[model samples]
Target chain A: MDAPTDQAPALVLGLDVGGTSTRALVATADGVRVGAGRAAGGNPTGLGPARAAAAQADAVGQALSGLDPAAVRYVVLGLAGGAALPSGEDMPAGEAFARVWERAGLSCPVEYQGDALIAFVAGTDRPEGSLLLSGTGAVAIAVKDRAMAARSDGHGWLLGDRGSGFWLGRQAVVAAMAELDGEGPPTVLTGLVIESLSLGGAVPGTESASVFPEGAAPVPASPASSASASPAGPIAAPIAARDLVTAVMSQPPPNLARLAPLLATACAAGDRVAEGIADRAAAYLAATLSAVRGPAAATPIVLAGSILTNPTPVAARVRTALAERWPDAVVTPALDGAAAAVWLALDRFGRPPSPAVRERLFSVSTAS
Target chain B: MDAPTDQAPALVLGLDVGGTSTRALVATADGVRVGAGRAAGGNPTGLGPARAAAAQADAVGQALSGLDPAAVRYVVLGLAGGAALPSGEDMPAGEAFARVWERAGLSCPVEYQGDALIAFVAGTDRPEGSLLLSGTGAVAIAVKDRAMAARSDGHGWLLGDRGSGFWLGRQAVVAAMAELDGEGPPTVLTGLVIESLSLGGAVPGTESASVFPEGAAPVPASPASSASASPAGPIAAPIAARDLVTAVMSQPPPNLARLAPLLATACAAGDRVAEGIADRAAAYLAATLSAVRGPAAATPIVLAGSILTNPTPVAARVRTALAERWPDAVVTPALDGAAAAVWLALDRFGRPPSPAVRERLFSVSTAS
Candidate 1:
């Protein structure tokens, strides 16, 4: 291939491909951002490589709309679940990345990185630290020299992921079911569940039935409508419990994570059961983080994901627990993933971005 | 409907309808078995009323073949999860039962009983007792005067059923995933899981990658063929772990129960992890049983369902644990459910059968 030698490249491409969404950015060698684009999630593990590659390409194509491909030099992409791929020539969405760049008409050596390293780099420039993330799922990773050294408890929903949004949501549903069945003590979660699932009205034809091994009785529910008014635990019409169960069993298990938002509302209303769940979630999260962290606690522990990033009782409790356990650890939020990815692309070329350039990218990403 | 009134009717219909299968029995008032039939499960809660009614009709029709429906003096239909239905004309698969009788051209009143009571009646002529059942699911029921007085933890898969087959199977899968991931201690469970799920081979194209919130690394596994032969924890080719996860995720959650049979083989081979799981399962089952039992220990507790009735480590442990907790509690096996339903029908007519008749029905049922 014939090429003109430019002393300084005008643009470098950086991408943060996540399970829910994919983002792309193009910036100058000196880290002055020029373009950004977004697309649907491109998690290769969840949504195979072809679909994932398509998303990555769409985002990259948009970001490079007005920019010339020949002007782009260094390129780097950070992908979630990148470590789960096969090695070397097939590393970290290897073929998917190839398709993305080829379709975008860009020719440059692309540095593919895993989410852990990218997230670590996103929060701090430090080479060694740890990361604890609690989103729909949860995981703890120890990073050393810009690479994932060790990790724990990201085993998916069927295996582990304790203290995750899915876990909390499951707890909420289980509690509501138990309370309405008279198999558990009263809890505000039951009322919230009735209200949330819209189980307040009569079920169409019959009361819901759950399987039992012996001496079964159809569930006990009066013909009366639901009385889910009080947060202190109103005795709901058992019919509501039946409806609640039907609604839950009808969907995929991961959808339970959607119920996680109910906890915040319950916690605000002083629901003890909600409070208890939050405490347990914090404990579980702390334990998972510690499993990968070992004895050293004096590193920057970047907290990421909605559960840790948002303002909830779970978040507050987790922060407190982490502080108590790792007194010397500096807890930081992962601010700007795509921008941080750009910083890594710059670092890969032996040219670190100035503090001002890093700030500029970080500020813009958060603002957006 | 026109019917011949035979003095001292010669036959009665009894059925045990479950989620997996529906068993129907036709016997003389003196307890001589005339006919028997079984068909696909007719659980209205799971299969819906119309389809469930169809299964019941099929089984009843088969049992009534070559027999005059006019000779039937009493009928009892026992259904699992019968308590969860609406009352009156809709009582206990009400329409489903009506369809069965109408289709059969039988005018006799069809009595509907719950599985708990039928299972309890299967083992005893007495009225007050308790039942502990562990099949695909688990439940505890207290029977007083031949009715369910109190119950606990039969809340289905999502909420509870702690020591049920579903629970044990889930635990086995989770433990296996953990061992292979190196997040937990190495156990024979990993090899068993690999063998059971047919995951010993490579996943078609992927080294299965699970979702993680942050600091993730794709799983670590080698390209070598699976070495799942060693029972005491072989470091399997990571590719096998990838396949194991993919297999587990592909099926419906309850299908995990299919893997439960693997535990018996592992326990026999002296796998510590397998033994631990069985013990824990037994403990949970016992606790659930104890919850509804209160302080009374002299009441007979009929241990019904596959996990308790079958000869496995879980069963043995549960028997021993129950004995230790309630020395005076007579633990009996529920011999034949359909036969028991017939007996209950006889009891309802104020005609407690002779010991010879009970023995004959019970023996005939076991033989079938």
Candidate 2:
């Protein structure tokens, strides 16, 4: 059924919609990429329905630009937060995609799927396996015959999502606070986080300029002269732990997730606190995997998302931890999700891509 | 210096500013309460500066409505988020409170103190002790001479605040989600939380009202004819775990704290999941206390905030856990924080109240 087709050229469109960025690919049935486009977040669950649909249209339009839209035989949208519509509604996510498809003037038959299923397929051609994701959120999904069967811990940041990028970043900030207040062992994370946030010695009232005694002669502001003149130059001032905390607290809450990479860097530099956070994240990911794996035998476990795919200490720890549990588990990183959607679309349209085509698709998509 | 004053019968005012409520009390130096007022949240750090000051002024004006403002010799404010000014500037919190005081036209000298310090004073007359607060947030502070000397785990909802009311509530939701998705054991908390949130049979498209087959008679929408209506009456439809999760996700994130009491109720009713959450909360609280205690000898440990004072399983577990480690330590519930501030003001003004006066103040404040 997945044999290479020698018929006249037909194209398929695949879209990976997420909270941060959306990517779309147009490729031929032989796995040769024809065009691609990118846009901002298109997850309807994250960014409301109208914006989500518009983003999808923009990406799809760009991908199909100058190309014959009529030549596209099928479209597959692999969307994050697409498993369920906004709460209290029972409309299938497919119906919403169909409306967007019609509005976009694309006559191709379109199918919608959860991003996790696409990620699993991106990693392997297996009919059944498991996918562990650790991006801004964490969850493990057991895939049976290319569909989600069982799941664990994708409860978002508020509930679980343990071992996720947000979780690690939050831990980094927590450790920094503890060290700042002398409640825990001093860690380099305190300094690194402060610097990462660009919080210097400019604390109000305590800044060198404001701390001068009344009627005291003002010292020259140059770093070298000021140090000798007043013995209280900005260079001499220490960063207050509370000030660092206040700086962090002032940021929009979700921005805390931005600190995850700094934590990874600190872990590589041998910061105990960062290493601890990494280890805990790995352990959590393992536990999530264990919960979802169930009785499945030596199936491939595809690791997806930034926290798992990135070359960070956490990814290394997770790989090591999972290796100890399921030695025979075919652990692999997911290929490009949009391309995976293309493969699924081909399969659903009764013309699955052959292994050679799959390789070509993965290579072409990954290179781009 | 420690004697009660009969010299002018001067009065003192105390204000306890919290996230949920602002409480103010006016009384004589000898501890005879004269007036009190209540208002919405006054935590400047939680609520913005303008609203926080307005709440303080409003509560103060009400408490002093019939009293002579000139008779008030001193004022002390015990504020939850008053220790640190909002991020960005260096102005001390005292200056901010002073502006509010001047605006309210109170001539008395005012002092501002952290809520934890006042809670310690409220529990005992000692100049030093430890305070453990578990409200919407949790923290432990070691107080020495009415000043915060050491602290642990007040990092707010994003970073720490473990074992807090918010933490417990978040855990409850996590458990409910886990149970709903077959990721964990089912418990009564799943039902209780869904009911508490009022998320019943209203799951958008999946509700009975919307689930009717196309072209089928709606059955007159009568309860008797509905197969789902049965012994449970109009509430026969079991809440879909997905729907409950959707409902919670739809709410403002902080509202998750409202689920804590429901969890406590479930624990009291013998739900294992609720009990587990309670146990974790207690353990986290204990760890926070341990981190802040530091080699102190027989110092009173004042447990303040609703989570600690309320008769919940977490509070009980905390008491038991503390008793095992600090048998010699005096465990006391904090008296009214506003009243404690009054006592501190009197002491600072060289008109310390006697033991009998302290008792009178506590009785009057608590009774109100």
Candidate 3:
């Protein structure tokens, strides 16, 4: 609770609060990181208002330890569900943060922006660019002067999110279901998904008899297979496919997103069905970017989110697609969003970081 | 419950239980309907086991009024979500219905089948055919000897159900959102959806200034427009599109299925956006049918579900697409699934119905 004095150095705080995690960082105006903290999901719309506020406070408080919060001149919060705030509210997140600041006996100005906007800043110092993100959800936003000008496909997991992690994972399950139901070609993904989900025991009535005909080739057993090999069980014994379905149905619906990486792994291992899913996901994401890109002929496009940051087949495909369209478009990967927020906050003080400063901030913030 | 008399005439009962409604019918072997009743949604997987069992009991009890339960020779249930039964359970729906029958003193055998199977029976006396159903959800199943042989795309609303009512409605909302955000072309749906949802008041920060630039054509006002005409409110006032978004977001996620008919209505009225949704929905359905259609060149294909039954543009498009592929395939509409189930049950007693009997049963069942 040290008060700001002539001896205290001015610093900036940057926060990235999302549905899955929250991150906060304090840095000097020159983009040198001073402190950093992390917390669980803090998206208000996803994790109610009170919890979201508390998460942000916890992350910020941890980041501000051993430092004078009063010396923090600017604060920028990049929030995932910011756009979904009730319109009638007056700077809700800001007010909540103000109370937190008061409790800590610190004063500072706070600015809130969409997660996509901060993600764009995270990739590059350019104020204007397009960002294509493919995390659990997928979206592309056209940013101008550090503000969102247009967007495509952030319609949650149901209606759109075409190329998102959720979409890819759901596609893998669909393919597996089709294969098990005898309506689609046999895929390596079927056995892979069964093993990954640990669906060993069978459920009655959904026997493989219908899926695998009398003379059809038997399903390949997984290396880690736990299912009984003997066919001499009771007539009413469960089927492997039925067990897989049960395993999937037992989980909360959104947990399906966890399967995306499995699909990526399978694709890398050369499974045709998995490869197709990855290709289609990348295509969908590329299309989303096309829909939201600005009219500027050579606007830089930043690639953000877990799917894009990872060196997966889908990410490779997306990079190739964007390269074909915008040969000169700077498609940089965003390593640390908190670092991006730090740079953005510093920009508010008319000291936008140079390339060297940006690199230093990214390295320092991501290192901790 | 009425006791069976030595001289009581034997009859069969048929029940069509769905997610929205349940219907039961008692009829003579000659297709003469004696009684009928209806109740709320009875899909066990959709409504859960208890509510579904209760719905079936209510509908069947009402249909059996004064009839002797012991005289009921057989009972066939066309159940939605039937295939999704957990395999380990013995006589899944049967055991549930048995309790109801025991209370009512019914002593007759009961058979349970998927709704698609009954819909196929409703369309044709032929034991083998394909049935394409597109209600709140959509699926295409191949039937062999009145049993489901193979299926395609019944992956519920989240994973698949591409050509379903839910799909169409969700597509409409996606389009409206795009138009509102100035990411897509202008469409009449923007106004219609707003008016239908009655989202009149403004929300802060979402003024249409960015969406509809100055001198650009004004958005077409709906016939029931309630938005302010002045267009000069507080700078923070909400936009009409924002209000529409709020209205949609306020509802439970699955309620998006309710918006499908509005899309259909708009399509019938020649809205391009709606028309596109209908055409795509039909095309997807046709593809689904093709996926599950038997190799037998002249397999009968039955079209069921509200989207197909209502004579909408989507049905017409699907019919055209299906007809072009299977020129000799018998494409029949299902009007009374309960009656169809009764006919199938009667066939179990060595009475495969004649065409005239089918017509009589449909007419009698639908008449009420």
Candidate 4:
């Protein structure tokens, strides 16, 4: 992006604001990069508008600092919440971003879209398609004429999000606990969950073995919880059910996402319990996609979010499920949301880039 | 009770400590109540040991205030946690209650029992039977010779307690939210859930109705969300999903229990959706009971917890299900936990009260 700004060509600014972080890209209509910057999460829905605004401004200002603000012809904003991004009063894409631009010395018409659209464009320059995402949460979107036509299953963790990272992680904990309590089938997941949480051998059983209320006898100790281990790291003692519960409950509910990766690891090693969880996650995601995409969907479908972006078991299973439903559908993996946002800006300005250009933009992508 | 201490006879003390409150009863060998007292909750598993001990001490001191310490020859402590009451060091029933008795100037051998046993005794004098309890939480206990022989599903709100107040209330919210999102069937639960949470047309959608991430078009405004009514109370425009989520997430998760009553009211008024929820709750409870009881469980079946003690549809349904499973089994509602503890105290001392005495003790019961 060091080509002299004195002769800088007309460029557009694209911002991908999400719960985890904010990224911005400034590039010319011809697909040559001009500037880039990033900051912490600026998702107005997840974080408040004020903080989200500050993060957006910080990233956008940095992206434009290396070039003339006047040359930044247009701006496009894509929020992670996709069509569900809160707006009327909360959309940083509108009021908050308006203030963000005014403070950063830029004046240009802006185009706003949900993260799903950006993710969709990142995979292809399609004007109509669908997007399926599963990160801390999960959602499916039906894009028509370059905008969301319909959506499904983004109701969030408590009531919905049946196939999300949070959902998978929660299942892992439930399975492990059930096993430890002698009420479920035994699996290596019991060991993995405890080890991942650093919850096994070292911690004293928080609940007393002689607790009277559990009755005259505690649950017949399962094989997995025979005795407490020494303070040796990794050589976990049979994890106590109480310890597992206290660990899971000590944090914000959504942090369970951190444990989702463990399921893939466990399932890969042929653990039936973990495999069952992975199967359910895949089915749940496919079901959500089915709700918005009618039986004979032939449009392009984009997959984004941490779980789907990586070459994980969950992702492979989901792809297989999707293929079964609509084998001919174009299934694309989303790449470079910031770059996709720029392409969208170009499209809004009636200068949509070619397929090669889309690939080039993705080439400048940073790893998630 | 103010019976004369100068002519005191052999008496026993019983304490029922729960998450909500602690109660104590002191009675003579012949079924005459000599003293009674109550204090805030002293369940060690729910509240920390120190606080639970203090509450238990407060209740016991009051119960024994007018009685001679020498006459208080035996003591019994039953905790609401039932068999799951953490013991080794945490059971307030053990070290904590021992300390409580010492502070109250009474020296007597004590018997510790789970609340299920107390509830079972509250219903009948049977030492071997079964108990099903559902309050803020739920559990099924199999009692043998006045001690917990086996237990099922006291895993608490996060993983178990499927038929509890918290579980039922959480279902109401989930159903209402699903309806509001237009993803599920319609029901009065939608209105009741909103009104009960005070979440409705009053909220400014909290989310910008124009939020871009939910895509370009918002959910085609359902018939329910057409207009925003003015500040006039109760004439709600329509409840917004965002407002409902915000309200539910803003409190301790268990507070959802507050919404359980609305389901009963809705079902009474012939709301199929509410009735469906009630049916599932009953089925879940019966399933839990089935897991612990044999096919022809002939022992007395004691029903405890606020839901079963009342005449709600859920309670009625559960009783019918139990009746179907075991035609001749005795099903009784738990009477008084403190009195039951007192009876158990006498029984532990080989002085089990007669049926007439048990009835007199139940007569002195207080409302929840």
Q: Cα lDDT for residue B16, model 3? A: 88
Model 2 C-alpha lDDT per residue in residues B21-42, reported as the tens digit of each score: 8999988877898879888888
lDDT of model 3, residue A234: 45
Best by DockQ: 2
Which ten contiguous residues of candidate 4 chain B have the minimum total lDDT?
B211-220
Shift in Å, residue A43, candidate 2: 2.1
Share of real contacts kept by model 1?
0.21
Q: What is the C-alpha lDDT of each candidate?
A: 0.73, 0.73, 0.73, 0.75
TM-score for candidate 3, residues paired by index: 0.81
Query: Pick by lDDT: which candidate is best?
Result: 4
Residue clash pairs of candidate 3: A203-A238, A204-A238, B203-B238
Clashing pairs in 2: A88-B204, A89-B205, A90-B205, A204-B90, A205-B90
Fold similarity of candidate 4's chain A to the true chain A, as a TM-score: 0.86
> Which stretches in model 4 have alpha-carbon errors above 4 Å?
A1-12, A28-84, A87-114, A201-243, A345-350, B1-84, B87-117, B202-243, B269-272, B345-350
lDDT of 2 at B56: 82
What are the per-residue Cα lDDT tens digits for candidate 3 across B34-125? Answer: 88989988877757778988998899889899888777898888777622522113345556767877876667777777777788888888
Candidate 1 CAPRI classification by DockQ: incorrect
State how far residue A238 of model 2 sits from its true place (Å).
4.9
When sorted by DockQ, best at the front, the candidate numbers are: 2, 3, 1, 4
What would the per-residue lDDT of candidate 3 be over residues A1-368, giving only the tens digit for each residue? 45455668889998888887889999987778888889888877757778887888788888998888778898888887522422112344556666766875457767787778888888877888899998887888888888788777776665567888888878887777766666555555665566467554332222333333334443443322313333354443344444455566677556777888877666655667778888899999988998887445587888987899989889999999888888878889866888888888888866667888787898764522
Model 2 error, position A48 (Å): 2.9
